[model samples]
Target: MNSKSHVPFIRTVKISERSGKDTIKIRIAAFVLALTAGGLFILFLGYNPLELYGTIISGAFRSKMAFQATIRFMIPLLMSSLGVALAFKMRFWNIGAEGQIIVGAVCASYFALFHDNWPHFLLLIVMFAAGAIGGGLWGLIPAYFKSKYDTNETLFTLMLNYIALHIITYLRDGPWKDPGSSGFPKIARFTSNAQLDKVLGVHFGWIIALILLVLVFIYLKYTKHGYEISVVGESKSTAKYAGMNVKKIILRTMVISGGICGITGMIQAAGSDMTLASSVAGGVGFTAIIVSWLAYLNPFGILLVSFLFSVLEKGSSVMQSTYGLSTYFASVLQGIILFFILGCEFFIRYKFVLTKKGGK
Candidate 1:
């Protein structure tokens, strides 16, 4: 007992390589815990947590109109999350989805505004093509720099988002500004032919989202390029050692990522907004990141997460009106859920150990 009193117990955390099943269990548990915590917060606010949750579910699903609105919000989120998931699978941070979406919407609007007399189907095809090209090009920029010079893609892509926003702002305020508007800065609306029609109360994009989910799942699971992407994501050096074209893979992956986001933009313009605007993306680009991550980059899993997000978004209005909660409260709850889920990953990957001091 040399002058030091030995502590009876000491605890430390250590990493554990948990199995996939175990990880999934932890994540599910985390979700349940997060909801419980959120309910406590509601109770603290003097509201019945059960009623609030019931209202949220009913508000999002009680009627055809409410359900349709939820689907409407889910389309863009599903598409955007799919796009973000594609790049995330390759470990490339393509955060410029906002800019890509803006570029896409702008390109689609250009055609809609100038070629309104074109055949309806033809214009639709061309508009979609223009959006994909614009977004692909914007995504290509960051990839080119990263592949050629090892630039930081996170910042580059993020900065490009603002650049794309300003570009749309200029168009809305200047050349493309609607003269018919009462001096308000707004882009001209697309003609009826250029706009998308509803199918059973949902836009046709819902079909596209479903099809893409299947295709993405197959592509990732059964393709050579997909294998290459997995290898590169696991380790670039290993990919290079295996003779894979790492740079080409990165460039190609980003294009697909950005191109998908572009399609999402076109959907926004043609299916919903029917016009281009600086706020066209609606921050869905960032939200898509959360969706993609929460789904662990699983294409099918994105559908589930996207629907959950849509419920929160659509139900927020109900909360605001019925319970006098701030409209942003939904966002706050969503953030807390995400935080708890992510933090749970830490516990999933590690465990705490307690031992007597000075004991082996």
Candidate 2:
């Protein structure tokens, strides 16, 4: 038998190089395809696709209040995505952002609950620090284990999320439960001084988020620490040969990553929720992981992606109300769009080749 007769008709080859413009073009095409596919789905449902799309857009930004709601949704997502991107850049899968956020909120809540009489600005600053420290410490745990024993960070971090949630349950049911809640399990709300003030009708967390964005961008692109992280991500062996302390970098970077996520918890509790709850994290940590990856770990890209995600989320509710669409239908549309966008990433890194019959 001739081996030549066994040749496959198609093969996938790695893309050795792709220009920025080409990559952008591919993504844009994917988005168009996604919209077309979603439009077909809407048409099948007895709705005008263009009108439905217009509703989605207007639902997110038709009025100042609507836009504010969208921004509210984006705030935590953008901050958490930025945090996750830092760990990802170092090739560390920090899946514990959810846990870190919870722990940070708990830590911040302690101050807000106990020190209500302190000066407002000073207290908020302190809560912010406490949250950052708590989150950083939580993140450092998995980093330490990974450095010393080479444990699986993903499972370790995931399990920690459950533990953190249970801790909140405990506090709500026992120690920190509001005494005046008449048998309902709940935590007390923060005082006015403990709450975050609004700037331009939105929580001041937006300001903090923007600041962190610039800082993270600078840290990732400019600093010596950033260079070390890049080297470690590419090849730990190479980093070691260059006299970089791999363990230290892992520990430090995780702390920073977790700390940023912790700030999200603080912002949510003080700026949005007005009290720490079991739902303080609100699954934003997990969603931020998708946002971070979708943006390819670029901070500015994260800002854009997070905003789009918020728009979809807010618009889905509007669709449910205005068009009588089921929540499931809205979800299906979102899934289709995400599917195409993510699918395009594959083509960016590789190409499919068709072989000629009887060719070597």
Candidate 3:
């Protein structure tokens, strides 16, 4: 034993870039693994996975009404996700979309509540503009700090969301409280003039969302600004070497991101709620981050992923009714899926290998 015995083997992990097809395969594998894991949990709870999955599919798509409801849910998610995608593309962590949405809706409500005397088209125009400006300004604040002082945008934007929520709460409980609702805290609903028209049971906001999708796709694919954003995202040093205005780019990108998010809030107010409230955004702003990442920040990919999430959201209610389970179970499933998706990236980028003790 003292005469130079050799060890068996050793292992080490190495990182490597994966091909496009391999990346897609890994993602698919992660998805399957997540579903399998979820099924195991369902089995442990004494529920039939096949039946539950079938119910989800049918609830989301079997009936015209069900499909329409899913579509309605998809609209805001799609728009908000696209908005988040814009900032994410440039490595900007804009976590304040929730707050930006609230600000936009609040600004738009100013017109709907008091300026109802204006022509319908004019009132709508004002609301849209107000929403965009309000959101853009909110987004610009974080960008300014990040550019000037290198502030942590994640915290700044996140804190802003709480502020926006408080603002809505104050407005609802104090100034904008509907006097007609007895003691209940409420904001006044918009008049018909301030509402969005529907075509075939879908609000015109769907049309706007679709148009923005195509525009965003084109902007990222073929525009010079999009290329500049790509360069900046890859490396600020490279962008600077290329003579790009980094600070201006940051501000401009955030404005676009926040403006789109604001429009989503306006659509929610005018097209769905027809009133402003703390829950007007309905958590779409936060959900949009998941949507954007799952879609790899591609506009068309966002649309597809948004639709899938909408199906889960719409179908989850049915699951609660049929299985007597909490609707939050759907959220749990989504979290599991995302967790696996993110975990799979590690395997895609790295692998462990075993070798002889003295092997290179």
Q: Identify the runs in model 1 with alpha carbons over 4 angstroms from their true place.
A: 1-21
Our tally of clashes for model 2 stands at 0
Report the CA-based lDDT of candidate 3 relative to the real structure: 0.89
What is the TM-score of each predicted model, taking all chains together?
A: 0.94, 0.94, 0.94
TM-score of 3: 0.94
lDDT of 1 by residue, 70-175 (tens): 9998998999898888888888998888889888888888999999899999999999899888888889999999999999999999999999999998998898
Residue pairs clashing in model 1 are none
- Candidate of highest lDDT: 2
> How well is each residue in 1-360 modelled by candidate 2, as lDDT tens digits?
976566678988898879999999999998899889989988988999999888888999999999999999899999999999999988999988999999999999999999989999999999999999999999999999999999999999889889999999999999999998886799999999999999999999999999999999999999999889889999999999999999999999999999998998999999999999999997888888888987889999999989988888788789889988875654565567678889998899999899877674
- Computed on alpha carbons, the lDDT of every model, listed in order, comes to 0.88, 0.91, 0.89
lDDT of 3 at 159: 96
Ranking by lDDT: 2, 3, 1
Off by over 4 Å in 3: 1-16
